[model samples]
Target: MAADTTEWKIKKLIQDLKDQYSKTVRNNPDTVAQIESAVRILSFLVAGRFENGEILSELIYSASNLLVFLNDSVFKAASKYVSKVVNVTKEKIKRWLTVLEYTEVFLEMAAKKKWGTKGAWIVITIIQIMKTALRFYVLVKLDGGIGSTPAIQPVDREILKTAEDEHDNLEDAWDEEAAYSAQEKTFTLQSSGRQIRTLQAAEPGMRTWGVPESGTQSPQNSVLNRKRKMLNQPASKLTKQRKWAEGLHIARPMAHLISMYISGLDSWKPFLLACGMDVTSMYLMGDTKDLNAKEKAELKRRNMMLLYYLMRSPFYDKYTKMRFIAIFRFIAQYVPLSGFIIRPLLEYLPTWQRMYFYVWTL
Candidate 1:
């Protein structure tokens, strides 16, 4: 009886997806390709085989293609129901773009190293699955009832449980990274070819803030030398002072020793870049600004240091991770594109209720 019920549910899900795909195809022939791609992704998920490059490639392409379509239509619909989902608008598509960009870079790196087909598939599968899972969660929520009680033979709690678990893991990872970053005083710097450069620590109006002079030096020295000199400060004091001074330092390639110790900073760099902000600059300019000249860069060196860690902090704890997901979920729920636009039609709902409805419809 249980087996029959489970089989029935799976069949129903597949049928619903096919129906939706057919409807989408009829209304927008241009989107048929994306719908097909989504179908392929679901197929891979159902099969539980991660080694197929052809399938993975198709999944990535379909995901990338649907980003634009989803962003324009479905995402808008979701937003109507969940407005504060993510701070960034259109994050469903943004997340897709993030995965696409990372996948391209990963593939290039894999190709350069002459990674075996299996190896390439392994890497791509991880990224593709992670991306798809996120999209699936949002969709399930958008459709309503990935969480709704099980009236007709409850869905696999494990699927939702695993997602919640992954979400928790990500949060915990973020928190752990944040804690480590705080104590480690991590800073991110840009690497040019072999040289890593960071902001100089010279006081405003003083020359020599992080620029290398005309002396040839080892690559390590080029980066290490950029750090503010202690100027004969004693050893015991050097350790104490460096800790205090780290936050004030800007744009300097993070110390090799420090960077090596704090692995989280490495991954956080891409995430920061995605948000269009430089980690080092934000660290140095407590409150980042575009100043022409003479503007005292609001240098809250210590605060900047703390903020770096805070940004990297893990969403490990269950509640903490849920909070993060809830944020995105809220935003996904609120958009004009997804559901009925009744703000003008029904003005009686309270402000919060109206906002809630708007997000839910999206």
Candidate 2:
């Protein structure tokens, strides 16, 4: 039953991705952009690996940037949705472009040792600078742009109900599947806020969020109730501290990016400024007493995501790579045949990941 629930979740995840991709495709009506994409794909088929596919890729990206000459209609589909959700906005697309740009450089370096010495670092620096500027704009212009991003389209309640039904089905299946000796096989009911859960006598009582066990509470049902409550609750306003913390947190990246962009900035200056802002912001927002339980968790999560900055320029190249290497080595130590499986990957994965990480922010 657990396996079935997991399978259902995986399928749902895939379906959601497909739906989003399709929506993007449907909304994109730019003929020139479509042609450019097609040409790039066809060129890749012929010379993607050869010459590192850099020239065509660069031309396409430049053409895209220059496409401001085209009619606004080309951007109409996406423009209407602009400001609706930052995730679907032009900034996200540009961030992806930065990733693609760096990826090509990574490919160039990984393929030919000679190519590695020739201008790849310059290309990577340029990508990072461009992406950081974009992030700075999004953070300041958008409302601290904090919190979990909602979907492009609001989800229907019916779909949620269906999912809840599946969860309930899984709960029922667990009761049927629990193994027990005949002496301990008696059926028992566990009250879990919204509904009674049928559980096996052999199953031990479980608790959630300090909801007392009292030998009758069901963990799974409690989880369902919490989820339902979260969904049903009305949206709440940010507390003064939360708003201030978010503002400062948003300012952290801005300060970092601004320092880089500014001339004559000395070493470790931007680093200090960014770190200082982050610590201050975390302290302010960490006071979740004024916010609801859910708000507190979300605030903390957003605070954690701020660590993505650690993966950015200067810091990533200087410090984070070592940490990643140490962590990877620790994990690989336990897995059998990891050395053989990871040997090929070790050479190029870091190069690819460096280029890829920025796109993950959105």
Candidate 3:
């Protein structure tokens, strides 16, 4: 009976997808091609044709691209009732799609450009696609039961239980710490007040003057005496103080090492280049009152050359390559000619990769 219900749900999902496609994307040939590619890829997956990691990777990548295309085209036009039922909005779906497409382009560039070989590209692409698909699938499946049984399973219950337990533990610990600190503070204040009163009662003669004599052993005078005694002590007695200062000096280098590890100082060049490209692309495509036509042309020329150099550079990692692709996609949306210039070089990329560029440029 459960098997039958699951089958029914899958069938309904497919029918709904078909209906959406017909309504929004049936008129576009390019969109039809994307749909066909997605269907073919999914069919392969269902048939267990993805026997190896490479094929499995391609299938997952294709699925992601398909999902993105559907979200942007079909789901974007979905009715409020349908969208609410699915618990997904057009804008939300678009953002996810953008991220997937950005990632896809990045991997594609990393594989083809950085590696400089089709075989290397295919391997890297497959690994990245698999990783991303697994992450997204786990998140969606665990969070909302997407394409799964709606009833909370034992695993889901355990996850919820763990989260609740952690939250309760944290709350309890904080409350206990706060209460202890408050009590300690109150006790200290009471002890200090009692000490002040005892000293005032014992020295009635000094209380009338409103000031303690310089020689009097008041709290302030005691603190000064302690400091003076410490400063005058032999070097052997100050071993702990010297050790503490040495530790602080050592911590400076340790902190620098930690900062380097966290900030990835060695990888800063690629990060900087990515940021520069993104900024430059935005400026060229955006309204700029500061630059004349000649200046803009000169900047555009330099920008194009820099983009080409980065695309051909082998030094960039997959993440850096993705940033470049994202920047290009953004620029291509405003400057159609930019897409044409790079089309020939990227002809060897997958259909989905090419389609992504075409879709944005269009």
Candidate 4:
């Protein structure tokens, strides 16, 4: 009787939460639509017993729709309900396992969807939830409560094949190593009861190898001498200029391409804009003499805008912000006294409170 009463109370609580959620969604037709879609998708999953290709397809479509609804408001409300239910439940392990399963399935579906930048946040959130559930499971086990281990499901084979195809395409796109290998021929020849190895340089004008001096020298000493000679040779002015131009040619276009790709992302617009502003500032600093007063004013306005955006963006975590700082620090080496820009950006980085607390405990 007691067990039956407990189960009834839990069901009543869940129903009450559902009722509250329904009331909240009533005013927002979009939320209602999203919830309905989720219910339909979940029904297929439950009805098919989490198997069958047709059901998985429906689940994937629904999961994609859910990703679109994973904004701050929706996520917060869902999190609050989950937290409250977890707090009130005696079957913590069962609740956590359900969450873990749902998160894993959603992540798998999201991966199959291949939504790129739009799905990044959804993937991150699901991974975080999985981590939390795993932690909870560990704690439960440590308390001598044995819970059923979650089974790992295989990801769709088509998704794996798609990833492999992408990798192959990337390899084909960047085949410089193959081209260089094809140009240079290294061969071993056997003649007069001795084997001779021939080395060929990749560059057209460079010699393959230098003849050793008419003296007994160890192989290590010979290698050191060759390296020292190569290092001592001064580069020609034209060669240096050509190398510099080649570097700029590679870096500038690549930077612009990256900026363009990142700027197109809804979540990354501010960061991309700030990066563009920094690049513009770098160019202005490089060639200040050519700039008119109006251009200088425009640069200042851009710098201010960049600062504002950097201050506003809370999307970046501590590590990401640190990496950005490191990049700017590297750029500072080329630009004269860029601390004016870099220092302010560094100051806006997330605080290390958690890190400090961990270190204090240690």
| CA lDDT, every model vs. true structure | 0.35, 0.49, 0.40, 0.41
lDDT of 1: 0.35
How well does model 2 score by local distance difference test? 0.49
lDDT winner between candidates 1 and 4 = 4
Worst 10 residues of 2 by lDDT: 150-159
- For model 2, how does the per-residue alpha-carbon lDDT over 2-74 read when each residue is reduced to its tens digit? 9999999999999998667545543443554566457555643443455645445444544443332231222
Candidate 3 ranges beyond 4 A from true positions: 1-88, 95-99, 102-162, 181-277, 281-362
Cα lDDT of model 1 by residue, 252-306, tens digit: 2123213323554234443333222234433334332432111221233323433
Worst 10 residues of 1 by lDDT: 145-154
The collision pairs in model 3 are none
Ten residues in a row with the worst lDDT in model 4? Answer: 353-362
Could you tell which candidate, 1 or 4, scores higher by TM-score?
Answer: 1
**Model 3 C-alpha lDDT per residue in residues 1-362, reported as the tens digit of each score:** 99999999999999998886656552453565576567656643443233443334454555555554554444224322122223344235334534444345445534554466554446443543443343344333323111111011111111111233544675566455444422232322355443122243235344432322223344433444454343222212213333333223223223332443466544554335443543444443444344343334434553454454333223343444677566666776678688765543333233433322221110
What is the TM-score ranking, best to worst? 2, 3, 1, 4
Instruction: Name the runs in model 4 displaced over 4 angstroms.
Output: 1-90, 117-129, 132-144, 151-362
**Regions of model 2 farther than 4 Å from truth:** 1-146, 149-199, 202-204, 207-219, 263-266, 289-294, 303-312, 316-335, 340-345, 349-362
Tens digits of per-residue lDDT for model 4 on 234-284? 212223333333233223323433554566433455455445544553443
Candidate 1 off by > 4 Å: 1-40, 43-279, 288-362
